[model samples]
Target: MKEGSRLLDEMNDRSREVFRRVVEAYIESGEPVGSRTLTRTLSEKVSAATIRNVMQDLEFLGLLDSPHVSAGRIPTQLGLRMFVDGLLEVRDLDHHDREKLDATLGAGAGDVGGLLDRVGAALSGVTHGASLVLTPKHEAPMKHIEFVSLGHDRALVVLVFADGHVENRLFAPPPGQTPSSMREAANFLNAMIEGKTLSELRRDMAREIAARRQELNSLAAEMIETGMAMWEGEADNSARLIVRGRANLLGGEAEAEELDRIRTLFDDLERKRDIAEFLQLAETGEGVRIFIGSENKLFSLSGSSLVVSPYMNADRKIIGAVGVIGPTRLNYGRIVPIVDYTAQLVGKLIAERSER
Candidate 1:
C-alpha cells in the first residue's frame, strides 16, 4: 500500500470515521467542527465527550486542528491532502456540466488564446473560485513578420502565426532606424523566417544574417540585430497566465477574521511570477495536481488551495494547464473532474486543429 493508504489503515474505525466527518463538515461550512455538531452529524451513538476525545487524538496525529483555544476543530492542510488522496470519491461530470463545458470551449475552434480564456471563465463559474489557464508559449510556426514604425525609437512588431493568431508587441528599435529601414528589416525577416517557429529561427538567424550581411545596408542590419536581441531570454512570458473570477474569493460564508487572509491573497495575486511558478510545477505532473492550503507556499498566507491539471497537444505532450484557486474548503470531488475534463477538452481541440 502507498503511504497515504497505509496511514488510513493505521487509524482505528472510530478515529477514521470521526476524522472523515470532521473534514466533511469543515468543507461544507468553512468553519471548525465542534463536538456538539459532530454528535448530531455522525450516525454513530458516540457521546460528545467520546467525539471530543477522538478529535484530540486525530489532532495529535496532525490531522485536525483548533482555530481557537475553546473553538471547534478544523482539518489541517495535511489532513485535507490525505483526505483527497485516500478517501475522496471523484465523480464524473453530469450531463448539464458536460454540455456547458462543451459549448464554452467549442466557441473558439481555431483561436487558441480565446479558447483558453473561456476555459478559465468556465472553471471559475463552476467552482465559484478564481480560475487560471496557463497556455503554451509557442503553438504554431510564424506565417508572417512585420515591423511598423511607431516613432520615438519604438516599433510595433506584428507576428502572424499559421494558426491565424496575430500578436503585436511594442519594442524599442535601434537608434537612427527609420520607417523605410524597418520595412526593409521586415522584408528581410519575412522572406527567411516565415513558416518557422521562434526556436527554429533563433538557431539559424546568425548564420543566415552573416551570409547576407553585405546585401543589407547598415541601418537595416542594425534594426534586425536589435529586434532579435529584444526577444532573447525574455520570451518565456509567452506562457500566458489568465485569471478570472477574482471577486469570488470574497463574500459567501467567509468569517470576518478570514477577510485578512483574503486580502493577503488579493495582494499575492498581483505577483504573476508566483502564480506562474505554481502552475509550472503542475506541468511537470500528469492529471490533476492538488495543493491544499499550506502545501503551496504561494497560498499559505491566505490558506488557499489550488486544483491544477495540465492540457496536452496532438502528440500527447503536455502543453498547458487549467485550474481553480479558492478557499481550502472548495469542493475537491466535484472540481477535480471538472478541471480534468476541461484539460482533456483543450488538448483534444488543439490536436484536432493540428491535424488540419
Candidate 2:
C-alpha cells in the first residue's frame, strides 16, 4: 500500500469528508458503512448518489473496500493509516478516564514489574483488547548475589538487583562443588562486577576468563560462569513482552466468521520473542506510534492494529513500551490518547520509583 503521506493531501474536500464519515461510522459500529448510512451520520446533508460516487472513488484509490457484493464499505488498512496520520483528531481523556488511570497507576507499586503488570492489565481493561508491556531490564546494578545448596548436586542462585527485584535460579554444581565454594564465587563476583550492568558484567567476565584462564582459580571461574549464565538468561527472559487479555479479542462482539482471524492473532501473540523485538521500534519515536493492519510485520498476517508508546526513565531515556492490540476497526481517536496517556503515566511511575 502507498504511504499515507503520498495520498493524504491528494484527496478533494468532498472525498475527504465522505471518507472520514465512513471511517468514523465503521469504527463506532464495527460494520461496513453504506452511502445511506453515511448520509444520515454526516453533519452536512449529502445526497446518497454523491456519497456512493465518492465511496467508489475512495475504493478505486485503495482507501476503502466492500467486503461483500451488496454490503457497505469499510476503511482499508491503508485508509486507516491515512486517517490516523493525517485526518485524525485525538480527543482529550475524559474525567472518568483520567481518574481511572490515576487510581490504577498513580499509587507507588513496590517494584517496577508490579507497576508494569498493572499498567498492562489496566490498558487491556480500558481498551478491551490484548495489552502488551515490554518491561525495562536490569533497571539497576546488582547489589548482591548468593547461592544455597538444594542438595543432590543442585543449588539456588539468588539475585538481588539494586532496584529490589529478587530472582532465583536453580543450578547444578560442577562435580563436588560445595557451599563454601559457592559463597566464594558470589563474593568474588560481587567484588568484581558490583555497580555494573548485567550486560557489562557479562562482557567483562568473558574477557577476564579468556585472558587469565590459568591465573583464575578453576572453581571460582566455573562458579562465576554458571552464575553469570543464569543471570544473563533470566535477564533476557524477564524483560520480554508481557501480553494480557488475549481472550478479550475472542469474547468481543466479533462474528463467527472472524474466529479464524482471532485464532491467527492468538498464534501470533504466542510468538513473544518476535513481538518483543518488533515493539522496540516504538522506542525510536518520541510519542505514540500506531501500526495499522499490514503495516507491521508482526500483525500483518493477523490483520490487526497496534497502538504503542514508549515509557521513559527519570533521565528521559526510553526504556520500554506499552500498547494495545486488536482488530483494525478499533476506535483510533479514543484508543490513541488512552495509550499515549498510559505510557506517560507508566514513565512517571517508573521515574518516581527510581528516585526512591
Candidate 3:
C-alpha cells in the first residue's frame, strides 16, 4: 500500500484502542485523560512510555488533545469525528429498547402531531438528554381556501392544499368589522387566490388591492388585509419543533455550575426558530451527521455534541430530522447508530402513514 494508505490503516487500528480509552475515560470522569490512565487500564500490553508516544502521534493527527501540561489527553472534536466515522462500532437496539420506543412512539397511530411529540419524548428519555424532532413543513400546493366568520371580529381561515393537508388559522379582523365585510373578503380571496402559494397570494392580494383601492369599500379592504396577515405569520413560523426531556439534563453527571449553563441552553431551545434552523442544516445531508464541540456554533458555548439523521418521505425527499444533544463525552459508538436507525424508523412510519 502507498504510504498514506498505510498510515491510514495503521491509524485506523491503533486509534480504535485509543478512542475506546478516550471515550471511556471521558464518560466516567467527564475530564481530559493522560497516557498513564490508558496504560494502566487498557488491556493491551503497551508500556506507559509507548502509550504516551502513541498518544502524541494521535494528538499530532488532531484526534487527541492535552488540556494541561503533564495531564492526560482528551478527544478533541476532530478526534470524536474520526471515532464516529471510522472507529465506532454499534449494535442494533435490544428488544427492551425497541419495545420501549415502540410503546412510546406507536401509541398514537394516524396522529402525526402526537406521534412526533411522543418520538421526541421517547428519544430524550432513552438518551437522558434533550431531544428534538423537526416536522415537515407544509409543502403541498394550495387547492382551496375558505374563511368562516366568528363573533367579535375574529374569522377562521381554512387552507386546503393539494396533498390532502388542511390547516386553519384564526384571524382577528380590524376593529369595527362585521360579518358581511368578512364574507365579502373571503369571497374575493376564494375567487382570486385559489391555486396560489402563500407568498403568491400575499403579493397578488397587495397588488390587486392597491390598484382597486378607489373602487372598494374600506371594510372589505381591511378584512382582506387581516386575513392575509394571519396566514402570513404562520408561514413565517412554518417549521414545527418538538423538544422533550430538557429537565433530564439537570442532575446526572453535570455539575451545579454546568446545570446553570444547561438551564440557559434549555431557555434557548424554547425559542423554537433557533433550534429549527439548527436542525435544518442536518436535514440537508444523508445518513448520520455529527456536530462535535465547536463544529456547531449554536452549542459551542456549552461544549456539547449533536448527532442527527434526516428522515425522508416516500418520494425520497428529506422532510425533517431527529437528534439528541448532550455533552461532548457522549458515546459516539453507541449513539450514532441509534440516532440513524431511529431516523429510518421514523421515515418508514411516515411513508406508511402517507400510503394510508
Candidate 4:
C-alpha cells in the first residue's frame, strides 16, 4: 500500500477521526484547530482531553504542528499531503462551472491571444485565486517579421505566426547600423520566414550566411546574424507566461498579519520568472499536480500553493500548463478539478483549431 494509505491505516479510529476534523477545520478557517474546536465540530462527541491526546500523537507522527508554544494544532505540509492523498474526497466538476467554461472558452480559437485572456480570467474568477497560463513552445510557423527602431540602438522585432498569434521581441543593434541596413536585414529574413518556425528560420539564416556572406554588405550581415540569434535564443527558449487575478489575493478576509506575506506574494507574482518556476514544477508530470508550501521554493516565502496540470494536444503531447496560485489553505478538493477541467478545455480548443 502507499505510504499515505498506510499512515492512515496506522491511526486508530478515534485518532483518525480527530485528525480529519482538525484538517477540515484548518481548511475552513485557515487557523490552528484546538481540541475545544474539534470537540464541538466532531460528530462523535469526544472529550477535549482525549482529542488533545490524539492531537499530540498526530504531532508526534509528523502530521500536525503548533505555530506557537500554546497555539492550537494545524496540519503540517506533510499532513496536508497525506490528507489530500488519502482523505481528499474529490468530486466531479460542478455542472455549473463546466457550463460556464464551455460558454466562455468554447470559441475564439482563431485568436490564441484573446482565448488565453479569457482562460486566465475565467480561472481567476472561478477559483478565487490567481491563474497562470504558459503558452506552448511556439510551434506556429512564422508568417511575417518586422524591425522597428526604438531610437536608442534598440529595435523591436514584430513576429506574426501562422496560428494568428503576434509577439514582439527586442534586440540591441550592433554598433554603427543604419535604417536601410535594418530594412535590408528584414527583407532577407522575410524571404525565409514563410512556413518556418523560429528554429527553422535560424537554421536557414545560418546556412545563407555561410554560403553567401559576401552577397550581403558587412552591416546587414551583422544585423541579420545578431537579430536571428537573439530571436531564436529568447523566443524559442522561453514559453510566454500569462498571469491573472492578482487582486483576488488581497481581497476577502485578509488578516493584518498576512499583509507581509501578501506583499511577498505580490513580489513573486511581479517576477514572471518566479511564477514560471512554480509552474515549472508541473511540466514533467502527467495529470493534475499539487505543490504545497516549501514544495515550491519560490513561493515558500509567501506560504503559497501551486496546483497545475499539463494541457495536451491531440497527439497526447503536453503543449502547456494551466492552474492557480493561492494560499496554502486552498480548497484542494474543489480547485483541483477546476484546474484539471480548465486544462482539458484549453487542450480541446487548441486541438480543434489545429484540425482546421
Kindly list the per-residue Cα lDDT of model 4 for residues 1-356, writing each as its tens digit. Answer: 76667889889888888888889889989888888887877878878998899899999988999998868999988888889888888879998888888888875555666787899989998888898887777777989888888875898888889989888877788888888888988888898789998778888889999998998889999988888656544443346677899889887878876767877876765654354454456667778988888877767787778889999888988867898988877899899999999998898888877788
Candidate 2: segments with Cα more than 4 A from true spot: 107-109, 142-195, 202-237
Candidate 4, lDDT over the whole model = 0.82
Which of 3 and 4 is the better model by lDDT? 4
1 or 2, greater by lDDT? 1
Model 4: CA > 4 A from native: 1-9, 43-45, 107-110, 143-166, 171-196, 199-238, 274-279
Model 3 — which ten-residue stretch has the worst lDDT? 230-239
Question: Model-by-model lDDT, in order?
Answer: 0.81, 0.80, 0.74, 0.82
Clashing pairs in 3: 33-72, 33-73, 34-72
With a 3 Å backbone cut-off (N, CA, C), the pairs that clash in candidate 1 are none
Candidate 4 residue pairs that clash = none
Descending-lDDT candidate ranking: 4, 1, 2, 3
Q: In model 1, where is the ten-residue run with the lowest total lDDT?
A: 230-239
lDDT of 2 by residue, 1-356 (tens): 45676776788878888999888888888889999887887777889998899899899989999999869999988889888888898988877877887888766656787888888888888888889888887646878878888895898878788778787767666776777778877776677667876777778878877887787668877877877665554335346678889889888567876767778876866644365455466867789888887778777777889989988889999888899988888888888899889989888888888788
Ten residues in sequence with the least summed lDDT for candidate 4? 229-238
What's the TM for model 4? 0.77
Model 3 spans with C-alpha error above 4 angstroms: 1-16, 60-62, 68-71, 140-192, 197-237
Clashes of each: 0, 0, 3, 0
